[model samples]
Target: MSKITSIATAVPVYQQSQMQIYDAVRAVHAGTEEEARVLRFMYKSSGIETRYAAVPDFNLENGRNEILHIDGADINTSGLEDRLKIYDKAALDLSIDVIRKCLHEYMNPSDITHLITVSCTGMQAPGLDLSIVKELKLCPNIYRTSVNFMGCYAAIHGLKHAHYIAEKEPDAKVLVVCVELCTLHFQKDRSIDNITSTVIFGDGAAAVLVENSGSKRAGWELKKFYSEINFEGIDDMAWKISKDGFLMTLTNKVPEILEKKCKDIMDHALQYYGITSEAVDSWCVHPGGKKILEAVERGSSVTREQLQESYAVLKEYGNMSSPTVLFVLEKILRRAEQNGSVKNIVGMAFGPGLTLETFHLANA
Candidate 1:
C-alpha cells in the first residue's frame, strides 16, 4: 500500500500575539474608556487566544477607519494584485523551507517526481510550483500541480492526488505543501463579520513528503478517503476577491451544521476499520475554531479531553487554513512516538463546499 513517509512545515517568522491584536484595536479607537476595556477582552471573546500575523506589527490601525479595522487584511487593499504578491512570496519561501527540511530528513530533492501545492489564501500561476523546482534544482521536467481556493480540506485533496500518483507508479515520491497567508486576506473594515473572521485565522504553512513503498521514513499508510457536503450551507463560508481584498463570510449558523452532520461523517469514516467512535485510537481533527470544536465535541461526544491538542493549536496559532490539520496530525504523531506505541491516526478537516474530509492513517 502507498504510505505517507514524512512531513515538514513552517510558519512565517513575523507574528502578532492576540493580546497585541486586541491592544491595537483599542488604541486605534480609544475614544472612550469603555471601548478600551472592550478591546482588552476582544481576544477572550474571540475564542482565539493567539494568532500569527505576517506583518510584525500588523498595524491594526491601518485597517480601521476610526477604530474598527478588522479582519487581518492589508491597510490599503486597493492594490489587490500588488498586496497579494509579496505575501504570496513570503508564504512560498516558508513553504520551500519546510519542503527542504522534509526532503533532507527523508529523501533528496532529486528523488521527487511529483509536486502538489494546496492553498486558499493566495493564488499565482507559475508560483511556488516553478520557484520550488528551480530553487531546489530538481528535475526541470518534474510534474507540478496546485490546488487553490479549496479552503481547509485542501490537504486532503493534495494527499488524494499523491495517492493517485503513487498507485499509478509505485516508485513515485511526492511533495505536497499547504500554505496560507491568512493575515493577507483580512478585510480592512469594521464590519462584525470581518472582525470575527480576523479573530479566527492566522498565517502558516506545512510541507509533507510521501514515497511509495520506499526504504525511508515509514508511517501513515494511505488507506481510504471519505468526503461529503452539507449542500444547504454552501454560502456559509466563502472567500471573494473584493476591492477591499478578500471578503470572508462566516455565519453564526455554522455550528448548527456541524452539530447536525459530524456524527454521520465520523461514523462513516471509521466503519472500514471495524471500529466505533469510542474504539478509535486517536483523533487528528481540524480545529476550525472555538465554537466549531465545541460543537463537534458535543455532536460526536468525543470528549473535551480528546480535543486538548486541537484547542492548544487554536490557542497558540489560531487557524492556519488547510495546514491546520497538519498541526493536529503532527501533535498526535509526536505523542505516539513518545509513548513508543503503534500509532493509528484518524485525520480529518472541514472547509468550504460546506464539507467534511477524513483520512485513515497508521505507522507503516
Candidate 2:
C-alpha cells in the first residue's frame, strides 16, 4: 500500500472577514431589511470567521472610500464566462505553488511516476494536470489521472487510485493535487441555501505525496479505503453548471441525515479490515460546516478532543471544497509528531452524492 509522505496547502491572498462578506451581500440585496437581518444572523452563527478569495474585489467596498459607495450592481452581475476566466488564470499558480512546497528539500520531482489532479470548481480542456507537469518538470512519460467533479471527497478518491498504483508497482510515486476556487461561484440570489453556501466556501489548494515504501521518511501508512452513498439524501446536496455559474443546492436537513447515517457507513467500512471503532485513535473529518461537524461528533464514538483539528481548519480557512479534508489530515499528521505517535487514524469526507468516503491510516 502507499504511505503519504507529506501534505501542503496554499490559500489565495485576499482574506475577507465574515462581517465584511455580510456587509457586501447586504449592499447587493439592499431595500430588504429582513433579508439583511437574516444574513447577519447567519454570518454570526457560521463557525467560519474568515475566508480567502482569489479575486480581491470579494467585498462590495474593496477599496477605501470616503462615503463607502460600493458598486453593488457590478459585483452581482458576474457571469459564467467571467468566473471561468478567473479560475483558469488563478488555478495554475496556486496548484503549482503547493506542489512545489510539498516536494521541496524532501523528494525529487523526477521520481514522481504518477500525477493525479482533482477539481470540481472549474473545468478546462487541456486541464491543470498538464500545466503542473510542464511547470514542475516531472517525468515526461509519467502516468496521469484526473478525478473531476467528485466534490470534497475527491482527495480520498485520489488516494484510492494512488493506493492501487502503489500496490501494483512498489516503486510508484504519486502526487495528488486538489485545488478549488469555490468563491468564484458566488450567487447574488437571496435564497437561504445560496446564503449558506456563500458564507462557507473559500479558495484553496492542497498537494499530497504518497509512495509505496515507508523508507527514509516518517508519515501515515495507507491501510485501506471505503465509500458509500445514502440514496435517501440524493437531493440534499448537489452541484450543476448553469448560465451564471455552478449552482449548489444544500439543504438544512443534511446534518441530521449525516448524523443518522454516519455510524452505519463507518461500521460497514471498518468491518472489512477487521477493525473496530475503538481501535481508531485519530479522527480527521471534513469540516463541511459547523453543524456538519457537530452532527458527526454527536453520532460517532470519537471524543470532541479528537475532532478539534477539523474545527480549527473550519474556523481558520472555511470550506475550500475538495482540498478541505487534506488540510485537516495535514493538521493531524503534525499533531501526532508533537505529542506521541498515534495509531489507527480514520479520515472521512462528504460530497454531493450525500456520499461518505473514508480511509484508514497508521504510523509505520
Candidate 3:
C-alpha cells in the first residue's frame, strides 16, 4: 500500500507583521482616500491578522527614503529579479532542508526515487527539483516534475502526480515539495483587488514523503482525485505575462462562483469517496483567504470549528500557496491520532484552467 511516511515544512526568514502588510498595501494605493478605503476593507475582510513575506523590509515604499506617496511614486520593480534570486534560493533551501529531515527520520536519502514540486508564485530554470537533488545528494536516477502557475491549489496537483506514480510503481518513493514567494507577485496598483492580494498572500514551503511499501499502511493514503476546469472563468482568476510583470486577476465573483458550483463539486467528490458529507469526521481545507475559506466551509456544510486549524494557518501564515494545505494537514493528522478511528480526509485546491483539484485522503 502507498502511505505517507512523514511531512515537514519551512518558511522564509524574511518576515513582516500584519500592520506592515497593511502599510505596504497602503503605499500601493493611488490616492489618499482610496488608500484608506482599500487598507480598511482588506484588513477587515482578510481574516488574517499577520503574514510572513519572503523579503525583509518589503514595503511598497521600498526606497531608502521610506516616504509615502499617493501616486505610488515609491513603488518600483527594478530590483524584482534580484529579489527573486534571494526568495527562490531561500525557498529552495528550505524545501531541501525539510526533505532531508524527513528522509533522515523515516528512510535513507538514497531511498527516494522521485521528486515532485509545486509552485504558483515564481519560476526559474535548472529549477527547484534539480536544486533539491544536488543539495540532498539523492540518487541520480530519480525522476522529477514541477507543477507551476496553478495558484493556491497547486499542492493537490502535485499530490495527484505523486499518487499516480505510487499506484503504478512498486516500492516507489516520492517526495512532494511546495514553495511559494507570494510576496514576489506584489503589485503597486491602488486597486482593492491588489490590496486584497497583498493582505492574504505569504511565503512558505512544505515537504512530504510518500512510499509504496509491502507492509500494512501506517499513515494517510490517497484514494481518488477529480479535476474540474470551468472555461467561463479563464479570464477571471488569471496569472499571466505583462510588460510590468505577472498580473493576478482574482475576480470578485470567486466566492460567489464557488458557492454556486460547490454543491455539484461536493456531491461528486462524496460520490467518488463512496460516502456522504456527514460521514466526513475530519476536513483538511485550503485556506486561500478568509472569504475563499468561508465559501468552502459553506459549500462543504462543515462547521466553522471543524476548520479551525485551517483558519489558524491563514491567520498565522496568510496563504502560502500550495504549502498551505500541508499546514492544515499537519493539524488534521494530529487531530486524527487524538480522536482515533478517524479514517478519511478531504483535500482541495483551486487555480488556473479555472480549475478545481479535489481528493479523498485516508489514514494509511
Candidate 4:
C-alpha cells in the first residue's frame, strides 16, 4: 500500500489580517456605503484571522502595490495576463520552497520516480511540473503528470494517482505538489460570489511524498478513495477563465448541498475499509470555509473537536484551494506523531462540479 511519508506546506511572504484583506477588497469592489458594510460583515464572519498573498498589493501598510493598483491608483482591472504573469513566478517559488521542506531529511530529489503537480489557479505549457523537475534536479526521465483546473479536490486526485503508481510499481517514490495562488484570481466585482471568494481564498503550496514501501517512521497508509459529483449543484461552484483573471462562482447553496450529502459520502468511503465513523480517530476535512466546515460537522458523525485541525488551518491560512486539505492532514499527522498514537484518518475535499472527494488512511 502506498503511504504518505512526509508533508510540508508554505505560503508567500506577504501576510495580511482578514480585516486588511477586507479593506483591500472594499477598496477595489465596494462602490457604496451599503456595499462596504456588507463586505465588512462577510469578512468579520469569515472565521479567518489571517491570510497570505504572493503579492504585496493586499498589504496596505507596506504601500508597494503593483498588480492591483497602478501609480497610487486602484486599477482593479488587472487582465488575466497580468495575473498569470505574477502566478508564473510566485507559484514556482512557493512550490520549490514547500518541496524542499517535504524532501529535507526524508529523501533525495534524485530518488523521486514520479512527479505530480496539482493546481487550478494557474496554467502554462512549460508548467509547474517541468519547472519543479528542473529546479530540484529530479530524474530527467521521471514520469510527470499535471492535474490542472480540478480546483480544491485536485490534490486528492494527485494522491490517488500516486497510490495507483505505487500499487503498480512497488519501488515507486512519488512526489505530489499542490500550489495555488487563489488571490491572483481575485475578482473586482460586487457580486456576492466574487465577494465571498475574495474573502476566503488565499495563497499557499503543499507537498507530500508517497512511497510504496512502509518505513520505520510513522506515516499514513493509503486505503481507499471515493468521489462523487453532484450535477445539480454544478453552477453553485465553478471556475472559469475570463478577460479579468479566472472567475469563481461560489454560492451559499454549496454548503447546503454538502450538508445534505456529506454523511452519505463519508459512510460510503468508510465502508470500504470495514469501519464506521465511530472508529475513525481523526477527520482531516478541507476547510473550504466556515460554513463548509460547519455543514460537514452537522452532516457527519464527527464533532467540532475532531475538526479542530481543519478549523485551525482555515483560521491561520484561510482557503488555499488545492493545498488546504493537505495542510489539515499535515496538522493531524504532526499531532499523532507527538502523541505517539496511531490514527484512523478520514479526509474530504470539495471543488467545482460540486464534486465530493473522500479518502481513508490509517497509521502504518
Q: Cα-based RMSD of the predictions, in order? A: 3.7, 2.6, 2.9, 1.5
Return the lDDT, model 3, position 83: 48
Residue 323 displacement (Å), model 2: 0.7
True-structure lDDT of candidate 1: 0.75
Query: lDDT of each model, Cα atoms only?
Result: 0.75, 0.85, 0.75, 0.89
- The candidate with the higher lDDT, 2 or 4, is 4
The segments of candidate 2 whose C-alpha lies over 4 angstroms from its true place after superposition are 29-31, 64-75
* TM-score list, all predictions: 0.90, 0.95, 0.91, 0.97
- Candidate 3 per-residue lDDT, tens place, 1-364, comes to 4667687777876566677666655555536786587566767677877676666545544443211224436456534465456656777777876677666657777788899988776678988888888887889988989998888788888888887888788778898998887777676765656666767888888888876744344678888888788776777787775544456778778877787776688788889779888777777778878888788777768779878888999988888878999888877887778878578877777876578888887766
> Which residue ranges in model 3 land beyond 4 Å of their true spot?
59-73, 213-217
Preferred candidate (lDDT higher): 1 or 4 = 4
User: Over all chains combined, what TM-score does candidate 2 have?
Assistant: 0.95
In model 3, the Cα lDDT at residue 188 comes to 71
Evaluate residue 17 in candidate 1 and report its C-alpha lDDT on the 0 to 100 scale.
71
Over 4 Å off, model 1: 27-40, 59-78, 214-216
Cα lDDT of model 1 by residue, 198-292, tens digit: 67788888877766755356667877788888887789977778655677887887888998889888888889655666655778888888888
The TM-score, computed over Cα atoms with residue i paired to residue i, of candidate 1 is 0.90
lDDT of 2 by residue, 1-364 (tens): 6788889999987888988877766765444788778778888898988898887655655664211234635544567887888898789989988988898888888889999999999988888888888887888899999999989899999989988887678777889999999988877666767778888899999999888864456667899988998988889899899888898888988999988999888888889657888888888899999999999988877677989989999988899999999999888888888986678889999999888899999887
| Global Cα lDDT for candidate 2 | 0.85
Task: lDDT winner between 1 and 3, please give it.
Answer: 1
